[model samples]
Target: MNPRKSDWQNLDLLLKSFAQISSNFIYDLDDKKVAELDVKLIESHLSEAGHDFADVLEHLCDNIIPQLSASRGPRYWGFVTGGATPVATFADWLVSTFDQNLSKDGDSIASEIERQTIRWLCQLFNLPDSFDGLITTGATASNFLGAICARQFAGRRQGINVAQAGMANLSVEVFSATPHASMLKTLGMAGLGYKNLIKVDCLTGSESMDVADLAYRLQVSTAQTKIIIASVGTVTATDFDDLMTINQLAERYDAWVHVDGAFGIFERILEGENLSNGLEDVHSITLDSHKWLNVPYESGVFLTRHLDVLFDSCDVPAPYLAAEGDKPEFMSLGLENSRRFRALPVWMTLLTYGKQGIASWVKRNIDCAKLLADNIAQSPNYELVNDCKLNVVLFRPTCSGLDQQAADEKTTQAMKAINQDGRIFVSPGYWQGKKVIRAAISNWETQIVDIEIGIACLEDIASKL
Candidate 1:
């Protein structure tokens, strides 16, 4: 009996069983452990002669599924992770079933769907029709795309094509006050050494860039070509750089402005927020659908008005691949020649929820963060590290009667204790040279009740410390 043919014969039954298993896990996510695993037990399952597909499925249900981290759960406050909505999950499954390589048009409707999704995203963000974009594999790739465009634009200004000439003798200066780590990695990948990043001074007691300092640096800088990476929402504090002033400075200095709005762009959906007022003036922007859009993993987008520069930077002249014409040939716009139909989930989620639903989700998550911050402020055991900005709360456990060093150590201990408690999950980091616990309220499922639970877990752990 050939296992492959046998599995094919029973595909329907196998798929049904798989769906049931997935449904059970998602339905029981609230009660499941946040994270659990035994490395030795997992290693024991590996064998040279694999079991039948049915046995493998049973093993996954019995062993692997139980040990996975429940990052999709409502109480997961780490890493700014977003949980997939039901419709989005369903759309993702459809994407897999269709399995279209969304590199070019004329093959399938996937390319058209992606184009429409991009246009819809632009409208949702109030961006002008002048902007064009392509979906990518999360913020890393999106930022990389932005960097590639910036490199091409800068090189063109110097009468050289960096993509064709390579980065042998050219130097491009990048300025940023609080660039995300991924942006730095993008610079490195784009042949502009990360070490060359000119660190502009941030505003006092804030992660936002200081416009005056940036102007001063730009005035003094001698680099022929420059790029400015502006942050819409910083990771640790959720603070936004002054994009309006930054764009003015970029214009004065003839610098290409790239806004890394990965998770921060959603904040614009909330009424009365002007943090992203000058977003349209920027040359390019990066947004992560997985972080705040409540979609599945590995989805992001890079938008730019300079489509010509993006094409010149990333396009590969191959006769087999179609050239850009009336429609976008996605392969020429960014990385990945054979790309997944990631836009389907985004498109479906947007269609189901519309703008109002997304706005409500963002506002609720911000409210949860604010609730946690208020609780931390009232508690004597924990100190609020920063004012709750957007949807991230930064705080630390107060260790009375201890020196600074000892207090920092205690903060780390408290963070560990809270994570180990498993009722909720939070991450540890340093804020202004002191240890802090960062609770990033990003999941659409997260609510005020989950924040209350987090506060309780924090209090319980702080009491022990």
Candidate 2:
């Protein structure tokens, strides 16, 4: 409500300031691996009077910006994270500026953009055109949608209408050899208790699920609604379960199969690789664009072969939505009612970097992982808990002449040191009853040199400990 003449000038100043900060941050990213996270929290309440946008932005830049971890940097290898590509970043800014609702009735063109992007994704993943999908917040949300679909399908098998009747008093059996934690949460959200998840044992000395155990479970299970959760890429170790065998069992038992390919789905892009050979036959699959696609956060995909099942389970009709009819209303198909233009970045990314370009980046990451894994395997001070399959290396520092408890402590301390060094970051995990460090190389910027630096950091920390 200040001078109307000053409004435009002030807006321009704020925009330019933000743009400069963003540009400079990206430009100097290589030099600063991690931000200075030494600032204290601002606990004061909001003021009654609003301040200028420039002042607010300045405060954020001074206080909030430095606390964020540099996950986009070359050596920031943690949590299967990836940095957004230039094309995707630009598209995201456009999305924010346009502020389109991506629903069919809200923005027809934006909705069509999302549909076209979904088609591109299907082609990129080598999936069938008949399969239907929607962009989600992340793998967790995708898993929940997939779970709801499975719940509805399984309830119908037993002459129960879950969508209409709700999971009031139904018992559907869910099984998984190595389900991600998100999958468990999905089951709970779908009204299936977490305690009800029947664990299927893994194959001996391997991270892959035990096909024999799965077959036996299917043979003995009396439940009409059986949902088999298989891992395309496990979180701890990047090992893929035997999808072909699991799908065969599912087909025999008339069960719904859900595969969590959160990060490993990109392995299909690798040359001479069939990482997802039988994935197309599964009932549902979860993929994350933010992980290996090098896109920004809040980008996930939930795809299903059972189009009718998905539509029947998720469709909620309203008087206003009736006219929208037949056209794809993302709100009607998935969880969120008001969705952002999440498709812009994905569409731009796919258009900018076609199959070959994406493949090159993915292959480079896998090669870097192999380089690190090879170095870890040869080092006398470290040993791998699991073989490097895809791009995750699970290894631990060796504490000679120490008990198992002491060795685990030493490994944890080494990981803390690496993270504290601010040059690189790696997470910790327990695999097959052994404590280990998990180094995932999914970032597009990660290279062989980064692998060398990561190894040097690990070795230096381990030696000091």
Task: For model 1, name the residue pairs that clash.
Answer: none
* Alpha carbon deviation, residue 421, candidate 1 (Å): 0.8
Worst 10 residues of 2 by lDDT: 30-39
Could you tell me the lDDT of residue 12 within candidate 1? 88
Q: Model 1 reaches what TM-score against the true structure?
A: 0.96
Model 1 regions lying over 4 Å from their true place: 1-8, 37-41, 44-49
For residues 346-416, write the lDDT of model 2, one tens digit per residue.
99999999998888889999899989999999999898878888888998887678888998998888888
Q: Kindly list the per-residue Cα lDDT of model 1 for residues 1-465, writing each as its tens digit.
A: 998898589778868996898899898998876755233355665578878877788778787788787898788888788888888888988888889998888767889899999999998899998999999999989999989899999989988888899867666789999888999999999988889899999888898889899999999999988899999999987888888888888888899999999999997777794788899889999999998998999899999999999989988778878665675588989898888999999999889999999999888988888988999999998899899978888888876688879988888788778878888888887788888888898888987778777888888887787
- On TM-score, the candidate that comes out on top is 1
TM-score for each predicted model, relative to the true structure: 0.96, 0.95
